[model samples]
Target: MAGRTEGADLKSVSPNQPGKDYSRYFQPPSLKEAKKRGKADVQVHYDFAIPEEMAGIGRGKHFLIRTYGCQMNEHDSETMAGILREMGFAQTDDEREADIILFNTCAIRENAEDKVFGELGHMKSLKRDNPHLILGVCGCMSQEEAVVNKILAKYQHVDLIFGTHNIHRLPVLLRDAMYSKEMVVEVWSKEGDIIENMPKLREGSIKAWVNIMYGCDKFCTYCIVPYTRGKERSRRPQDVIAEVRELARLGYKEITLLGQNVNAYGKDLEGGSYGFGDLLDEIRKIDIPRVRFTTSHPRDFDDRLIEVLAKGGNLVEHIHLPVQSGSTEILKKMARKYTREQYLELVRKIKAAIPHVVLSTDIIVGFPGETEEQFQETLSLVEEVGYDSAYTFIYSPREGTPAAAMEDNVPLEVKKERLQRLMDLQNRISLEKNLALQGQVLEVLVEGESKTNPDVLSGRTRTNKLVHFVGDKSLIGKFVEVRVTEAKTWTLRGEIAAKVEV
Candidate 1:
């Protein structure tokens, strides 16, 4: 339901005072050493144990969670769901029908925060009708000092607040909020500590999210991920592999290795025995039918990793390599170390090795001091790459990031125009790409029914292209061959080629 909206402009809601930029503290390690020494020392803390008496407090209650933001937050919601269910809480879809409601939020952009605030306001009437109803907020938004202060001062109805680091303590936090009759606020504002063996309730039966690593060390000047997600920490390789093996045992067909920068996995551990490539090789050996990982940094993407992806049969062919800018000048201002030539070369190498691989990318239309030429360079790059899809946006300055302090020279109207142009180009390319698949059969992993039309089932191709076809509900979670009948800019219309043997 959180699909891209049309002609959305990034607006600044909250502004901060001028100060020495803290963005340098979260800078990505040098390219030469990132694969070797980029990993930070992780101090695992398991001391915040939940009390036994409060374990079954939710025995007669039902709760529901609405997650916003990136995949990382969704995975966190899954963990929270698992925790609540463990304490005897039943899941509900309608917030009014439930005794508790949790909003797992995102603070990447100001609009995200605005949406969360609006939802909280809407839930206020619900709280009035059912005074016993518990309302809570968590995730990256809670990590912000400004967000916490505003919530404490104005949104007195908010029952509980936690941050990215303290999710493992949610059970206890909820219990305290309920009993104390006081607002509960606990957020750690520092590089975080890792907590392992946390509960998780996955949303899908065939697909599972396995966090191979946590946090981001790359502090892009316009981004807030490094601050919200703590310092980077890779999970032990054996632990990750073991988790995947269990998922395979549970009959899961797909596994998405999650992280702030997934490709940087294992750089923080000692002895340098394993890296992301090593983990990919290990996971490929497992019996999971599909393996994918997000958000590889172009600065850390190397030859060895590309080779591994090419070699690994289980690793999917779609790669979401984000090249936020095209001009070297703009990239440097953005603190994206790689140049446009270097990014293109990497793309060339990837395509050379894996000829059928479809490529996707992230692009920001306007930065602090972007010029028309630089914007044109981005347009040229988009044309050159012929991307299968793109996530394009007009830049919004996040408070505390270095770019926020710089003069935003690009006019709002210009930013919107550039974003529209970029989207138009991408849509044309996407349609052309999808057209090539017409009359061809693609292996699609059936996810569920299409939201727009339930009579049609939907899934995705290995290239991560969405496809919709008329099929029985029994086909859900199974891989089926769909012959493309029509091609749209965003999705494919298809028909079942044959009945799946399974």
Candidate 2:
């Protein structure tokens, strides 16, 4: 710890580099400032070129980013990787070989943060062995005041800490951390601007994630996203469409338009009446084989979006509409802004528009003050909806959220029992749905080899069902027809019915 601050006041100057704004590094995330949705317009920057002085700073370095969170975080990691590569840093899967290691973290749950902290403790020896190695923490977790302060006090070896808003400033931050003895921390508390023309090193060529918007306005009481992510601001529709078109041209088979709440896209656009449905209507005409968007709020599932989705073509029939709770009373407590009947009505509308739709949702089992009757209401709703699948969780209290202050009346054993029941019910429903697909031929975009078996291949259908089949290595990126021969609770085993010649 003493070695960390040995030259804290000294700043090593890089050759030919101008002085930087050191005060910017002093800013840390503030929950109070993040909560405000001011009238200031979100500035859009079309130009995001890398600084010339730091262009080759990473010429002899390698980086490894351990990401934890949702698809949004995964996509953010891609952008950061692209930036690092542009600065001449190569990516490595092993931490031992990395000169700079970054933990792109998540703050949605306590367990996730615990896992990251455990890893940070494990990295202490590595930092001690290689004193020159730089360790950083970024992403949603870095956007919290408590999280940043905790790292400062406990993890003195961590040299860099930034947030989701200022990812475009990676080069500058990296340079500062590399040169300075003091820990560099820069996290924006307010909503960030929309940065265009940012580079990305996607995980794969077959499937991609394109972010259409940022932030969420629907402040669900149990959620910390609205604070960590800031106010909802969307990218220009033209920029989004252009990205999709370019992806299609690059032979990408699928793209999932990402957002904290995708349904409310384009609502923050100035002087424009366009909405998510309008954007979808445009992307549907692109040459991409499949298009999807996620993590929708049921309150924003408007009729226009349903009608456009019904047009089919590249718009896949799988919709991940998150209904956090089935009981209206619990939902009200969670501030979901919709009743049980309202959610069912929205589901009915979506089904009416697209009859073959495979519906999936999110459910929280034991929230604060939840009664058994309310839990039963959730079970009945699940039965009525006949959902293909669902992501269920026992409610985890997020710090700084409204629900965190509420009395956690639900006991630990009861919460676990309720979660078990919910998972059991959902697993049965999922198996039944998969059984119905047995002997039916479905179109699957072959992703890659199965993790467990090298001889077998893995892919997903139009409805986003994982199907494992034995195939040639060459079929990894092509769309093929597979007939389901066996069905399990979570996946489908199939044999190739036919192959599309590329």
Candidate 3:
């Protein structure tokens, strides 16, 4: 069920690669030229012929990758891990025990970059102790020009720096880094290519992440994703279905279809021959038990998808639709392409279609020019929506985003206060939502033990409510029906359902 590739191989058995560390090509990435790489209508043809073997260049070396940000980054880490495994590198959790440490970073927030730098600083002493250690930084953060310059100037200990594009060239890059005297930095911001056949290592047995598409087209003013991730490119619908089929064959019960804007899938290819709705319909035919998707854009979300969800058997009763703000002015300013009224209408339609559907969203407390009136509008929207849950954060401007250039008149104190107020509202709403579910029997897929109590197992219902119940360790990666005994803001306490009907 694996997707086939269309790229021609550029064959060359290098003198020193994979195992041997002889540098033939090692050069730093030019951040200056990367700005123009993600323009619309750019055709990105992938290079699929990764060397079947890398001449054992990474043999006897230890490698570790710490990933940050969204599911895209998490999936990228899996791909990178696969590449590392192919290169003969052993995995390690401890950086002190590893010969190579890679930070698969995120650039969504300023704090994320700060955390990365702080870790890089900690690794400087480690690098000083073991000069042979190959420290690298990849993923979204490395795509930033300023971040890379800071790494090159201040954090010289970093040995490799590649981007979202050209991860298939990791073997080539790794071989170069092994023997080269200079740091290897090649961050390509090209419109991302559809790379199939990269070996993937997923964490969970029951749940898996299948990327339906890559990159983003919506240049939301406050977002750096379009720049860091590149233009929207969907994996062919057949290819996506094939992967899902494979996962189903392997006993995976659930899969969260991964994408920056999932509902925007298939718009870029073959003149809209197939779309996210069509893809979901095809996926539903597959034998998987549960299907879910995330980070959907409200503008692209249409009646077709809602209709499909309404007719669901395998599709879960949960949707994470991110309404970044509630003010029409804010939405317009953010270039979200959907008005607050439009968003609320969409929500209404979805709820009408599926009465038990649980809705979650992401909300930013304070944007650059947001006034108290606009903020109040946001609060009103929250109350109106009565969201099942929400991820609320104070606005943080990304450097290259359009919002960054605007005057951030909203004080930090004000932003923090708004954020707290938002959280307080959302928490109360969440508790109310869960409280309504109390005493109901829910079918929970046991993912793992509860973080707070090992004796209890933790899993989520099809409605995506987290339920913790007393269970054995053997129940992990299995499904069970639990009766809700208690309800809280974030999670529920439940027990094995009795034979008696509710």
Candidate 4:
């Protein structure tokens, strides 16, 4: 909304000040130390205010964000983009064409971190060529001490680096970086307070990602989320409901309530006075066409939550409950706080309540001491649940988590083999599940043309299944009924059954 067009002027002026000496901020973090920090209670609720004066400093400039991570990171990039846009920095799709480039990174997987660094390496020439190209990195990866150290030691060209907790301070950080010659590093170590009322440039026209909460309390040994993201803190109920209502009024059809552990919402404030189920009940009243939530922990999921799903309205019939492992022993090792039997029981209860519900899960194939029998237990669980789909992975130890210290004695070849076997079994199950939907009408929120074929429109079922069907491009953003004509392992093919008016 600036009068003067941004991204038109570059090579104006440059002021490089060596960033302030914050060496301690880059020191490697220990899992034990991180655990203690998590235990040390601090304020979870506070008002967040961004620096207003620097809002227009980026007028006549452009910035590009290369986000690497999951949906949370993608959403974080949206917030960052909105912040940059507010500062009059137009977003440039081309990295080399931008005045400033920011990377919103993830630390969940070591490979993800490596990929980020690889990109940084690739962008070194860009920074060298464009001295004014303010390179910034933030998000879960920036929260890691090792990652920070690596960046400071080698990637000195990065102008700014901040963490997940301090996104509200981006404009201030950018101002500091713009004036300074050194890298601006400000990563918070504590469970930072909640930030509400941040502007976001969402990706989809019909669907949006709403962060109902931040961080995770579940210290699954294999996961670095608890350490990187801090603890579970839910957004205020009214704030969440307001977002849903606004999205509905804006004609958005679907809203996914995102959180590291969504089922644990509201446990932080008022000693759990109101829970996630109640929150969903209120959101349902907002009357969005479809509502869904992810990454629910079995330990936090209760009978009440299941009951709400049973009496569904706008809430979708799909749940992405991450059962990290199917083996009870592995579950204990991961500190998931729920046994396999308990998880199965929860699934059973869910199915009883919502009989038509489709389930998807996360599974880790290899662990420190997983034996053949234990691996079999995982396979058995897959068969028992008959999951619609699963995001299966071979365990990859993250440096600062408890699992990293564990002896990775599982042979690499064996781990790969186990992973393949698991996928092979799951593929059959997925194909079988999809085949069962043949000729059945599924309500799909038409997203857009399919990636492979433009003549065919693509969308997702309420159960979160991807379906591609032949239709006009104008069908995008509207819900339509598609009868499954062909079922593949991963996607469904169909012709347009009819249009649905919500």
Ranking by lDDT: 2, 4, 1, 3
The lDDT of each candidate is: 0.82, 0.87, 0.81, 0.82
> RMSD, model 4, all Cα superposed?
5.7
Candidate 1 wrongly placed segments (more than 4 Å): 1-40, 45-50, 499-502
TM-score of 1: 0.91
Can you write out model 3's per-residue Cα lDDT over 290-326, one digit (the tens) per residue? 9999879999998999998998888888999999898
- Which pairs of residues clash in candidate 2, taking residues 3 or more apart in a chain or in different chains? none
Off by over 4 Å in 2: 1-35
Clashing pairs in 1: 39-267, 39-268
After best superposition, candidate 1 residue 416: deviation in angstroms?
A: 0.8
Clashes of each: 2, 0, 8, 7
lDDT string for model 4 (229-291, tens) is: 877777888888998899999999998888988899988766677999999888888868899
Better of 2 and 4 by TM-score: 2
lDDT of 2 by residue, 1-502 (tens): 1111112432332212234333333333334545557878999998997899889888888999999999999999999999999999999998888999999999999999999999999999999998989999998888776777677767878988888888998998888888788777767666669999989999989899999999998888898898778889999999999999999989999999999999999888987589999999999998899999998999888999999999999999999988888899999999999999999999999999999999999999789999999999999999989899998888898887888889999999999999899889989999999999999999999999999999999999999999999999989999999999999999999999998653
Model 1 lowest lDDT segment of ten: 1-10
Reference-based lDDT, residue 135, model 2: 97
Q: Candidate 3 — which residues are off by over 4 angstroms? A: 1-55, 498-502
Report the C-alpha lDDT of model 1 over 189-295, residue by residue, as the tens digit: 44456777777888979889998888887878888887777678888887788889999999998889999898788878887657898889888989888899998
lDDT of 3 at 426: 90
| Predicted structure 4: lDDT | 0.82
